[model samples]
Target: MGTQAIIRPTTSQTAPAQEQNFGDQFLHVFLQDGTPVAKLGCGGSHVLNAAAGQSISNNRWTPITVQYNLPVGKQGGSCMIEIATDNGTAQRLEEYVSHPVSEVT
Candidate 1:
């Protein structure tokens, strides 16, 4: 199996934040054969996103993309890890990226 991850600047916000907290910012998504296993927060999760800020505005989402691959007969999978945070500036218009990885071991 293999995976790739990337981080970049984005200014897309799909929804408004009502509760401003770390716990409330968490988002989860788990898929098995391209189907949702269960409702979010019901148990273990494969994806969780907590970007932007805590407010009812059009804050950025800071989306993270994770790619994974599974062999035909292999029993394991692979994916990449990502970390995103503000640059300690009033306007989050600055970003740094290390090039995209084509594969993961």
Candidate 2:
């Protein structure tokens, strides 16, 4: 089985907004019978360089959480994803950051 999600920027002041001129973010996770195999994230013209090699699996209802610490004055941000499998261990996936186009001076 496979799962996918699209992270889009909203106009809300407290939401995670994408930089102007950049495209929406995309995430896809591939699994085999519930075992995670690989995942990827891409947006605009850039793709993440991390590899998803974790042996995380679940057969019941699970809770996944993603957290980001976008520093002030920075043009991009980093995120951490965690998935709670049926084994009771929360697996932390590889972290990824965004690479947006730099503004010309």
Candidate 3:
């Protein structure tokens, strides 16, 4: 299967600290057939993301590992990881992200 795909949040316009909230980030994993096999974790980190086409039958409790993919806000900005499931209609997890504060700003 494809090595784990790490996608950083897209930045369209400069946003304020509150605007950087990622309460609806979804990790979409596609199978070899190009069909979205599973929708795991909402935001991105510290959650169990679905492994598409990985021969996983049991849908429950799929092992997942999430890591900080990018730095948000200023240098040491604050961020969050959201878990989404049930056809992207629900949010299951939310966690705060902390890092060294940026020297600038």
Among the numbered candidates, top lDDT falls to 2
Better of 1 and 2 by TM-score: 2
Candidate 2: where are CA atoms >4 Å away? 1-24, 37-74, 94-98, 101-105
**Candidate 1 lDDT trough over 10 residues, lowest sum:** 35-44
Top TM-score model: 2
* Cα distance off (Å), candidate 2, residue 95: 3.2
Q: Compose the digit string of candidate 2's lDDT tens values, residues 1-105.
A: 123322232332232212222124444333333333222243344443222333333333332322222211235545434433233454554444455533222
lDDT of 3 at 45: 48
In candidate 2, position 27 carries an lDDT of 44
TM-score of each model, in listed order: 0.19, 0.36, 0.24
Off by over 4 Å in 3: 1-71, 74-89, 101-105
lDDT of 1 by residue, 1-105 (tens): 111222222244332212111231122322222221111111123232322221211233333222222111122222222222232111111122232322213
Task: Give me the displacement of residue 50 in model 1, in angstroms.
Answer: 5.3
What TM-score number comes out for model 1? 0.19
lDDT of each: 0.23, 0.33, 0.30
C-alpha root-mean-square deviation, candidate 3: 13.8
